[model samples]
Target chain A: MNPVKVIINKELKVIFNSLLFYIAFTVFFCTTGFIYWLSQGNIFYTGQASLGYLFTVFNGVLFFLIPALTMKSISTEKRDGTFQLLFSKPIKTWQLLAGKFFAILIQVLLCLALTLPYYITIACLGHVDHAVGFCGYLGLIFTTGCYISIGIFVSSLTSNPLIAFFSTFAITIWFQFLFEMLSSWLGNTFIASVFMYLSVNDHFDTISRGIIDSKDIVYFISIISLFLALARYVICKSRI
Target chain B: MNVIVKDLTKIFDYQKAVDSLSFEAKKGEILGLLGPYGAGKSTTLKMLAGLLRPNQGSIHFDNYTYEKNESKIKKLIGYLPEKNPLYDAISVTDFLFYMAKLYDIPRYKVTSRVLDMISLCGLENEKHKLIKELSKGYRQRLGIAQALIHDPEVVLLDEPTTGLDPNQTFGIREIIKTLGQEKTVILGSHILSEIENTCDQVMIMSKGQIMAQGTTAELRQAPNSDFSLKIVIKGGEIPAIQEALNQLPQIKSLQLQHKQEFEVHCTPGQEIERAIFELCKDNDWYITEMTPVQMRLEDIFRKVTQKQ
Candidate 1:
C-alpha cells in the first residue's frame, strides 16, 4: 500500500473512534439546525434561507472545530513517540508529512460531507442557486484546508494537544483579524493590500461568494503549501 | 562482510559524546561495545546506523562507504535504539507490516513474513493486540521483530534486553544468538556478564575511546608474561611447600591463599604445570586441584579503562 494511504487510514480511524469528533459533529449539526430555523423565522435584514448563508455560518463554527480535530494529528504522534518510530523507517520525510496533511484533510472533508442535508433543505425551501451553493462548499473546503495546514504547523510546535489547539486558534485568529486592523491604521494602499491579501478571511470571503478568482485559489493553495512546508521543516529540525 | 569504523566522532553542543572511536565487526561475529554510563556506546551505534551524521569519521561496510551511499548503508543495516520506540496504537502485526512496507518488501509476501517474524519473536499471543497494551518484554520483542522484519545484514541493537526479566532476557539472547549465526551483530551494553556470555569478541570503551578490543582469552593471556596458577592442596606444611617451589628457577613468587590453597606468580620462561608436577614428585604434596585463573570481563574492563 502507498505510505500516505497508511497514514490516512490510521488518522481516519482515530478521528472516527474519538469522542471529540462526535461531540464536534453533534454541536455543528445542532448549530446549523438552529441557524437554519432562525433564518426561516425571518429575523432582521429579511433573512433568507440561502445555502450560501448557512455555509458562511458553518465556516465560522468550523474555525473552532476543525482545529480541535487536527491539533492531534502530529502532536499525538510525537507525544506517544510514534513520530520517531516513523522516522526510523525507510520512508522519506516528505512522504510522512504529506501523509499527515492528507489524513487531516480527509477528516475535514468527512465533517464537511455530513452537512450536505443543509444544502438540500435550502434547495427545497427557496430558489437557491446550485452553482453558488457548490462554489460555497468548495470554498469552505479550501478554507478548511488552510486551517488544517495552520493546525498542523501548530501541532509540530508542541506535543501537547491543548497547546496545539490554542496556539493554532490564536494564530488563525490573528491572521483573520489583525490584517484588517492593520489596514485601517496603515493608510498606505500597498500596505493595506498586503495585509488584506494575507488574511485568510479576505480570500475565503471572495471565493465563498461564488467568484472563482484565480488569485484566491492560488492564495489558499499557497497557504496550504507554505504551512505544510513549514511543518516539514520544523519537524525535521526537531529531529522527530 | 566486515564492518569498519574509522575516527568516528559525534559531538552535541560542547560535550564530545564519541571522540575518534574506531572498531570493526567481522562477519558472523558479535562485537560487544562495553562501556559505563555516558561512555559513548550509543553515539557510536547511532553513527554506524546512519541516524547521526558524524562530525568526523567514515564507516565502511566492506567496500561501500556510509557517507557516500546512505540509502545503501541504511538498506544494509537495522538499528534498535535504547528506547524501543514503537507505535503504541498499532498492533504488532501492523507495525511489522509497516516496516516491511518501508523496506519495500513484496506485497504478496508481507503477510507470511510478518507471521514468521511474529512467531520468531514469540509474539504470537500479542500479535493482534496494540503495542501499548503489551508488557515491556513483549514491546521489546516487537521492537526486535520490526528490526529484523526487513532482514538487514547488520543489526545494531543498543541495549535490546535492558528492561526484560531473566526469562525474557534469555529469550532475546537466544533470538540474538540465532541472528548472530548468519548476520553480523553489534550489541552495546554496560552489562559485562551479558557481553561475556554472548559476544565472541569484546570492545571495552571509556571516555569516548576504546581502551581494549580482543577476545577474552587473548586479553587475559598476555604473551611473554609469567603464568599465574592457583593450586588447591590438601593441608600441607608452608615452609616445605615454599622450599619445593622456590627450588625451581622459573617459580619467582609464590603465596598461600588459605589452609589448602596457594597462588604462584612465576617469572618469565617458566612452564608452570611441569615445575609443579616435578616438585610434587620429589616432595609428596597431594595436589587436590590445579586451575588457571581466567580473567573475567570485569577485571579486563577495569585494567584497560584504568590504564594510561
Candidate 2:
C-alpha cells in the first residue's frame, strides 16, 4: 500500500471506531433539521419553495461542526508522540498531512451524504431550483474543505486538542468575517477588493448564487491547499 | 547495514543536545548507547533514524546519508521511540499491517510479515484485540513488531525496556539479542544492566559527548585496573606469600589482609593468579580463600561521566 493510503486507513478506522464522528453526525443534522423545520424562521414560516434559508443555516451550522470533526486529527498525534513514529517511516511530511486531510474529508463527506434526505424532502415539497441547490452543496463542500485544512494546520501547531479547537474556530471565523469587514471598511478600492476576494464567505456566496466564477473556484482551491501547505511546513520545521 | 556517524550535532534552542557525536556500528551486532538522561542518546538515535535532521555532520549507512537518499535510508531503518507510541484504537494486526504497507513491502508479503511479526513478538493472543486492551509490556511488544514489520536492515530502539518489569524486560532483551545476531541494532538506554547484557559494543556518553567507546572489556581497562585480590592461605607463612607477591612486578601495592591472608593490587593488563598458585604450591600451603576483584560497571560509569 502507499504510505498515504496506510495513514488514511488508520485515521479513518479511528474515526469509525470512536464516538466522536457519530456524535458529530447526530448533532449536526439534528440541529440543522430543527432550525430549518421547527424554528420560527423556518421554511414553513418563510413560505418559500427554494432552500435559500436551508443552505444559509446549514453553512452556519457547519461553521462550527466541521472544526469539531477535524480538531483532533493532528493534535492528538503530536500529543501521543505518534508524530515521531510517523516520520520514522519511509514517508514524507506531506504524505502524512494529505492522509489526515483526506480522512477528515471522508468523515465530513459521509455526514453530508446523510443530509441528502433533507434535499429530497425539500424538492418534494415544492419546485426547488436544482442548479442553485447543486451549487449550494458544492459551495458547502469547498468551504468545509477549507475549514478542515485550517483545523488540521492549527492542530499541527499544538499538542492540545482543546487549543486546536479554539484556534481553528478563532482563525476560521476570522478568515470568514474579519476579511470581509476589513474590505467593507476600506471602501471599494482595489486593495479592499483583494481582501474581499480572499474572504471564504465571498467565494462561497458567489458559487451558492448559481454562478461558477473561475476566480471564486481558484480562491477556494488555493485556500484549502494553502492551509494544507502551512500544516506541512509547521510539521517539518518543528523537527529541526 | 554498516553505519558511521561523524560530527553529528543537534542543537535545541542554543543548547547542544548532541555535540559532535561520532560512532561506528557494524552489521549484525548490537551497539548500545549507554548514557544518563539528557546525555543525547535519544537525539543521536533520532538522527540515525532520520526523524530529526542533524544540525551538522554526516551519517552514512552503507552509502545513504542525511543530505542525500534520506527517504531510502529511512526505508532501510526502523525506529521505536521512547514511550512506544501506538494506535490504541486499532487492533495489533491492523497496526502492523499499516506499518508494513508504509514501508512499501510488496502487497503479497504484508500478510505474511504481519503474521511473522505477531508470532515473533509473542503477541499471538493479542493480535486480534485492540491495542488499548493490552498491558504495557504487550504494547511494547506490539511497538517492536511494528518496527520490524518491514524487516529493515537497521533497527534503532530508544530505551526499549526502560519502564518494563523484569519479566517484560527479559522478553524484550531476548528479542533484541536475537535481532542483534542479524540486524544492525542501535539501542539507547541509561540502564547499565540492559546495556551490559544485551549489547556487545558500548558507547558511554555524558553531556552530549561520547566519553568512552569500545567493548566493555576495553572500557573497563581504562581506570588502570588497580584491583586487589584477597587470598587466604590456610596455614601458609604470611611473610613467604608477601615476599613472593612483592617480587612480582605486576603487584602495584600489597598488604596483609589478615593472618595468612594477603591482599595484592595488580597493575592493569597483568595476570598474577598463576604466580600466586606457584608460590602456594611451592610452600604446600592449603589455600582456603582467593577472591579476585571484579570491576563494576557503576564504577566505570562514574569514572567516565565524572572525568576522573
Candidate that would win on DockQ: 2
- Worst 10-residue lDDT window for candidate 2 chain B reads B219-228
- Give lDDT: candidate 1, residue B191: 89
Sort candidate 1 into its docking category: acceptable
Per-residue C-alpha lDDT of model 2 across residues A1-240, encoded as one tens digit per residue: 777888888888888888877888899989989998899988888887666677787788889887787788888899999988988988898899889888888887787787889999999999989999999989989998899999999998998999999999999987679999999999989999988887888888888889999998888889899999999989888887
Model 2 clash pairs? none
lDDT of 1 at A80: 75
Give DockQ per model, in order.
Answer: 0.36, 0.79
C-alpha TM-scores of all predictions: 0.88, 0.92
TM-score of candidate 1 chain B vs. the reference: 0.87
Tens-place lDDT per residue, model 1, A154-191, is 99989999999999999888766788789867887899
Deviating ranges (above 4 Å) for candidate 1:
A31-46, A185-189, B62-68, B222-228, B233-287, B306-308
